[model samples]
Target: MRPVDEHVAHAVSLMAPVDLDEVALAEAFGRVLARTVTARYDSPRFDNSAMDGYAVRAAEVTVGTRMRVAADIPAGSGEPPALHSGTCARIMTGAPVPHGADAVIPVEHTDAATAEVTFYQSAVTGAHIRRAGEDARAGDAVVAAGQLLGAWQLSAAASAGHATVAVRRRPVVAVLATGDELVDPGMEPGPGQIVDSNSTLLSMLVTAVGGVPVVLPRCPDRPGAVAAALAGVDADLIVTAGGASVGAYDPVKADLAGHGVEFFAVAMQPGKPQGLGTVNGIPIACLPGNPVSVAVTFHVVVGPMLRALLGAVEPKVLAAPAAEGWKCPAGRAQFVPAVVESDGSVRPATGGGSRSHLVASLAAGRVLAVVPAEVEQVYAGDTVGIMTSILENMG
Candidate 1:
């Protein structure tokens, strides 16, 4: 059996970043930047007021010193006339400061009149003025290539005058859930059949990890249907859930074994049976069937592959203290669904161990507590590595 690290390495090795495309800021979320983003102009664009106040000469405004309001400048208005000696301009938040104004005294500190104003105290030089390029100067790098785009990144990019960005195209991943014992969710299954949850879990996981998930219909245990499904799907990556085991009805293994697929054993709890293959140069990753196993393996294995395929920077692994004790499996590494406490300690979502199937009971977890192969048990306050159950939560 291959080690979990080896499997993870192999999964990453099979994938490559998709082609880059220029996407509008409206559609940049969850995408990786293909090129470094530089500021086109200064962040503030020009010296502006940070608050609704009077823009005045610093030395002119003192306790009981009054000045005539030379002009009113609100945000987005054209440039106002220069400030004359002993005079100030009435300014609103984000309004450009008039030339010769060295400070902005907020309206709250004034007499609250529009035509004339008196400061409670002396105006500090450069106070409440947002200087141009204070946040970023022209040509300053705002974001690096391979960085993932989120709300903050998009906002910064827009502020940098980028209407569109060159980002790695979202990898299209086709999901084929293989089994005869599984039926569509919301449909009553016949005897000996259960509802299919892998499709739902995988598709959402794929989207969470920044991929375009295309979930196909469930494939039956028959060889012909499995082959046809494998041959017909078009995507950047192909993922088959189930049928990697040595069961009698495991058609994914029985039919695709020698047909460009390499079914193998991975030394990990709940996700031991795995397969790696390619079709027309597109990478394929086969995961185990049980809902919990499917989720765990995706977090531990497939999620990284998808991120690599999307050209995302490497994921950051975090370590936390184990909140409680549990029996760790022998010979195979174990990954249990867990909730990381606010203090950075983690505990299992359920008392029941990492059984290959128990997704229903483990739904509230946000992380997967990992135990190494040689460890036989865990004690309270032990340090353990963890994989975020929500793939996007990593880094």
Candidate 2:
């Protein structure tokens, strides 16, 4: 029996980041940057009008002074007549301010004509002009390595002339759901058979965490099939959702051992019987068959390992508050499904038996409330450990 944190640490340490690849800007979102992204050109590139206005020399706009309109500059048109002495140009939003124009008086403040314009107010130098490089300068660092790309970041990168981005490769994980009692959800099962939801549920979760999920053929209760599957699957990581316990049919442990897999298990309830090993140098996470058990173990134990394998700079645990009062048994860590409310509060969700493979509770839950082995009693608002699905709100 080992501590849960120790198990997590071991899994993370055993994994390494995948290689880097250059992907199109559209495909780079949610991937960690493998190299620093510097700006190729300054944003705004040149001084431009911030609104529909008259671009004129600041010196010409004395109190109530009027100037003639020389030309119109609409956005995206390359050229506009240069501003002459005592003259202005009709400039639209994002249009480059004409040369020799030092200020922009908004259209609301000026009346315009093809050859003349009336300024209702004085203008200050550099007014309403977005200077070049105001947002980002050429060669300036826009994004650093190891940073996760968001929509806004991608847009900025594109604007700065990055058509493709180098990001840490997403790990390919092969999923093998074991157990003879487990049956595909769409198929009819014999007596004592159960639907196989672990693979389906876990695959989505893995993709959500930025890991690739490969569903392999189900392995039977026999050790031979488990060993063959473990040996034959090709992936950076392998996840099996059953046959990790001490049952007679639990062949995952012995099969992985035959392949020289190395790892340990943690002492925790509902998820106590789990395994972590490596077959053919590929990390293997053998999870319990119970629905809630596998989900909790994935969140607490496997998620971090996946991130580490993907080269995430900081592998974070999803945490929130406990949903309800919890009493910890003598020795094992307890994981309970809980709803994380909008107000940053957490409350328990139903379905917690080890044998009951209830995925509905997991779908409704926003967090996984954790009760450590040292904790004997837990009450509401006690600041318990939490693993939140809303990664942004976890902070």
Instruction: Identify the candidate with maximal lDDT.
Output: 1
For residues 1-395, write the lDDT of model 1, one tens digit per residue.
Answer: 88999999988999877899999999888788999999999998999999998999998888888888879999999787899998898999999999999999999888877888888878999999999999999999998888888888889999999999999888889998988899888999899999998999999888888788998878999977777886767798988899999998898888778777898889899899999878656788889999889988888888889878777777666789999999987888999888878888998888887888777545778878889999999999999888766654524
Q: What pairs collide in candidate 2?
A: 318-387, 318-388, 319-386, 319-387, 319-388, 320-386, 323-347, 323-348
TM-score of decoy 2: 0.83
Off by over 4 Å in 1: 223-225, 342-344, 391-395
At residue 142, candidate 1 shows an lDDT of: 96
Please give the CA lDDT of all the candidate structures: 0.87, 0.79
| lDDT of each residue in 82-197, candidate 2, tens digit only | 78997888899999988899999988886655577778899899999999889998999998787678887788789889899998888888998988888888999899998999
**RMSD after CA superposition, every candidate:** 2.5, 3.7
**Candidate 1 local distance difference test against the native:** 0.87
Error of 2 at 222 (Å): 2.0
Query: Model 2 misses residue 363 by how many Å?
Result: 1.3
